[model samples]
Target chain A: MAQELTTQAARDMAAANGDANRRAMAFTPAVDIFENDKATVILADMPGVAADDVDVTLERQVLTLRGKVTPDAPQGYRQLSAEYQVGDYIRVFTLSDDIDQAKIKAAFKNGVLRLELPRSPKAQPRKISVKSA
Target chain B: MLQTVFSPRNNGDLFADMRRMQSAMNQLFEGTRTAGQSATFPPVNFWASQDSIVMTTELPGLTEQDIELTVKDTMLQLRGTYPEPENGDDITWHRHERVDGTFLRTVELPFRVNPDHIDARFENGVLTVDMQRPEGDKPKRIAIKSA
Candidate 1:
């Protein structure tokens, strides 16, 4: 609990100091975690990333995103002003067993990363009826 | 231009264009797909506005120098050559989705573009081009007269 609070505080501080890092990361990706009959979708905004540049791994219920930015600057560039640094990007998330990892699907379009995580049949919500005698 | 090097004026038909595109595709990206696969470019999403058109290509390991953009009267061309391969790298089973080569993508814009006003900026591995639409195509407000 303390660690979580610390991370939150760090994020708040980062937000307060807008230009502290110069590298922009969304404080939190707008994740619309939904439950249909089967799955949950995680759409992350990770712009400027290509399919080859991203690495998604799931181990022990932990999903991680690792990406390397291609140095898009020209060779031997004596840049006058550099704001965005080409570096590694990493993010991680913990998943519950209710998620059906096998049914997960991912697609990237227009810099948005979409992840569809289907749940196991047993984990799906169902309406139960109470019968009166 | 050397007359011999240029395609004969008579050979500028659709078939000749297809042949040239196919040959260029083969020379650019060879042996990546199936033993005998169809020709295609990797996935990308691009759009345009009234003032400028945007072409966002998925190219990892490519620098701005390796990429070039040229706009003609009605067409936008992008050619990118991948950076030099890592020195004597050994590889095994790898997911190589970063297709790299002398790729040339030519897209005819909806309207003409002024090459002089083409501006490009690269950030976070994405290149954003601000090409001014031809002056004639720009919208201008007309003077209203009393009826």
Candidate 2:
């Protein structure tokens, strides 16, 4: 089914840790998560982030996603109005033990990031066979 | 600032909580959706110089072929469709926040722009359109004489 799109202003990341120095503004990217029998997938929307600038790292049970974006205001132009601000994207996810950390894969295309986390073989459900003598 | 709130196993769905917060925010800013407001899908920002106007919007997961742009006098029209991802019945969504649908919007510029002088580019999922003012429409300065 096709649904109409709605505009939402980007939310600025709060300084919970009280960091003194921050070079650029950071916004949490909207994401979607899904799971099947084999794997769980995540999709994030981060516009203006180049493929080379995306960073995804899993340390212990935490998965971190970071994308840097260069300020895109055109030179020699005065800003008339702004509905959205361009900024870096950051979001973190805590993975479960069912996920296979070694087999996780990620791909970035058209400013969207797709992450695939395969379920660990030890955690997969298997059917038990019965033998009748 | 450190923000980490994606809990797939323990917290159920964080996107649902976010949606709840977003709906509350939407209620707080209820009057933003007034008539003639172009604040629809793919929010845009505008810039202007002495003789040109630049328009930009962010549209992730879309290519050049997916977008259509047309300029007629002072009206600029943008139309596009975001294709849905291919998924089988076996897949079940835990949190579906990313949107996929068709969008069409027409914006009226401050002044008429020549269609021939317009340039558009799609880079890193952001579309930028640069339009130069028509030569006949430029303001002419008058020289003052002193006696």
Candidate 3:
């Protein structure tokens, strides 16, 4: 059997609740991870989230992406029907040792987040020269 | 013997059964949820006012040029295409969850609206459409006077 490359492995992070605070629902954003010879790129759909509201953190080989979305209902309007739920987007990924932590770069535009994780020099493929004896 | 009893084949069968059951459950509960929650891409919310009807939807990874909106009678139509940025041959995909394709969403308004009075705006990937109700269709308040 061949290993499946596209894995939907992201799990929901439990919300913390207290008496004084109400926790809103958090949704898992759809993400795509693509790899080239130089880097691994991740693109996530986070609609309604502003660029400044997104937070990406890497700790102990765990990479977490979180974005806060503020509801944009017009004033003096009552919601009669809703098809999609309003909430924040959260996802986490476990990074392998082959990824260079220091060289990772991320950018957000038009509600899409792009993250590039460059491969370490040692992990890149190199051709070996052979001499005839 | 115990290892063989819990072999890879058995595990695979168990996972397959679980996946099948999950999808079956999803289909069972599909339409019971809110309209947007159960629908396809570009889920929308509808709001009503005395003089206008409003709708909003999220369309990430799209610009104004990628979307088209149309209003006909009491029907509102939305059409858009989300293009994939990377070429298939150039990169190896580890996880592909975001759908990229053309999508069409048609919603029927409760009341007829004036086509000329409709307003739409796309900001930060969210599209809001406001349709003004015809003057006669709006709710009217009648006054009672003493004879």
Candidate 4:
């Protein structure tokens, strides 16, 4: 059988609390978070992740963002040097009660995930939205 | 009896001096963490074959129009600019980690590449560059002549 064209390599997650059952390494993606009177927005960088491979879930007061990367090492090519490790991305954030849980919006483009958490109507009357989100 | 605590030599901003000293201390311990810890903007990975080489780097939230690629002999240059957030001054920042600025990285290929044959593609926020060596530079077997 021929080797797979694309493969996902696993790296050990740094400072990982003992989650021995986890298969692949999970990296905490770099993010930028900002808020206005009406809503809060988050942007995360998760390269090499396609739309279908990412998951965003909200449970209780925690919002989790996970992305799986499928790295393609060209066939028959030997890696000469690697300055960055390729792996999955995972990040979590705690949402306060002021946010409207049902109105959260998420969009992924160009390997960046934008999440918008609209403020609850009863919280405040001020208005703000992060551009398209 | 003791002399005054404020010396005459101090003239500049005290906070600026403290900031500089703090950064100098941070640099002293930065190298001990790992080999990948450096000031390089976007880290890269390289692969090579018999006649070709491939280089890739991750640059999220950027389109092809924001990047520039160039090759000169064995050096490959990549330059890119990240767009700033939509509203610069209005929003309150909760956490600011992503950076916005221009970055330039030049990598030396293992072999002198044929500039005309270089192919680059940007997809999923990753840039992949495939470069080929010139025909004359490829290894060739010489016929052994018996003297």
Candidate 5:
């Protein structure tokens, strides 16, 4: 039941994510996240997204992912086979306060976006070795 | 077995010839050999930098948990699973474009990337892999001796 609920929530979020300016947009972005020693890395799959067209905004605790992809042809060309589309991508994620907002960073290359979210300074690794002074 | 590739048998060696034809057909009806857009394989681009090799691929419609990345030898591989659009069926697609399938794209690396240090991240619809070079391979500044 919970899984179903979450899926439904995502659907709702996607619907609420897009805007009118975009020629097209993706409601969802395929992504993968992992934790490292210093930061959490987030990878999103956005084909056809141009570098200048992407917008990454962090407001309060919500991270919004947005971008636009340029269409290949202006018009009037017969497309032989097209497995990709042109559109903008919009999505939002509620983040925890454990993230260092000021230190968050992002990069877009080859249709992929990488967001680096550093852990809070307090979360840094420290050794609590027993030193009987 | 290696020489058999050159042997004369209709197209080549009987088995080798058949395999070549099959691969060609797959590329035509489907695509060369790309991970299906429906499958886990996201499209990405990888290039070399002065100190590191970077890779990026597309993975729209997936959350963070839907991907898995692994490195072996000098090759990097990504795998993941994602649901097709809710309208996967409803669409009377005049032209279909998303590549979907159980897709795995293996990238061969020119230099070895420290597996322990490999960093994979996702945002928007792209996956970025930060491949750090082995310590010894990194450039170092030499001490300047007095001339």
Candidate 6:
């Protein structure tokens, strides 16, 4: 079945209010959300973000994902042309009542973050058997 | 009865109008999708010094074995694939926005590079390629003779 995907939020660059030390940009990573019978899964693409730099937190029904991308330019080279933008990634999502918040699991590999949010038992569909007298 | 008669639209009609508005909004944002499909994948950043040129690109979900890099004259070509994750038959997707498949990005540098002196490294999904400028292409600083 085709799933309806929605972009709840967008990538916003960090505000640089005349601060010389402020970083140039911050992007919201592209994400994919999917669901199965057991759980809903979210995949976020954050290239250049190492596993150690990623932080995922759930607080009061709100889930937040943040990843920092360290600049990896080779030593003593000055940037000449930059066709791609680079920066940290931040995004948040509100959890629904059907999600089992306590059982959420997350994994990061190859700069892709995978989150699994299991469904509550009550939310799962059950087959009912009718009795014939 | 008076309110119903004077109402601008019914609930069903209102919902249909909202659906229409949503689709129209989506159409407005369709340009973002096409913009990303242009000739670049794993978009790159380039740097130049007196003797060398450096380039870097982001390649998430890829490994060293999945990529091929080639440099000839002043042109550098990168080819790679980001394989999709395996899922069971019962899975249902709610959203899929990331680009997945084979991609090739070729960039032309301002000066020819030495093929034997090129260096490439992949770490944390980022690929950095460094190439030394050819001896003939390097800028020569001539010493001024005292008159």
TM-score of chain B of each: 0.60, 0.73, 0.70, 0.71, 0.59, 0.71
Ranking by DockQ: 4, 3, 2, 6, 5, 1
Docking quality (DockQ) for each candidate? 0.04, 0.55, 0.56, 0.60, 0.06, 0.53
Docking class of 1: incorrect
Per-residue CA lDDT of model 1 for A10-109, tens digit only, reads 4211232334554544332222233444455554544476667667788877786555445444333233333333344555677777877787898765
Residue B76 in model 6: shift from native, Å?
Answer: 0.5
> Comparing only chain A of model 2 with the true chain A, what is the TM-score?
0.77
Which candidate number maximizes DockQ?
4
CA deviation > 4 Å runs, candidate 1? A1-63, A67-133, B1-44, B87-95, B144-146
Candidate 4 reaches a DockQ of 0.60
In candidate 3, stretches whose alpha carbon ends up further than 4 angstroms from where it belongs are A1-22, A124-133, B1-39
Candidate 6: regions farther than 4 A off: A1-21, A122-133, B1-36, B85-88, B135-137
- Residue lDDT tens for model 2, B6-112: 34553687678788779888887877785433457668899999899999999988999999999999999999999887588888877666767899988889999
User: Which has the better TM-score: candidate 1, or candidate 3?
Assistant: 3
Q: Alpha carbon lDDT of residue A46, candidate 6?
A: 84
In order, candidate lDDTs are 0.55, 0.82, 0.79, 0.80, 0.62, 0.78
Interface RMSD of each: 14.8, 1.0, 1.0, 0.9, 14.5, 1.2
lDDT of 5 by residue, B59-122 (tens): 7656568778889868887777765532433222221234444566776776888888888776
Q: Clashes in each model (backbone N, CA, C under 3 Å)?
A: 0, 0, 2, 0, 43, 1
Better-scoring candidate (TM-score), 2 or 6 = 2
Could you say which candidate leads in TM-score? 2
Which rank order by lDDT, best down to worst? 2, 4, 3, 6, 5, 1
Which pairs clash (backbone N, Cα, C closer than 3 Å) in model 4? none
**TM-score between candidate 6 chain A and the true chain A:** 0.76
lDDT of 4 by residue, A3-107 (tens): 112122432253333466655567777788888767888899998999889899888777878888887577889999998878788777778777888999999
Candidate 1's C-alpha lDDT?
A: 0.55
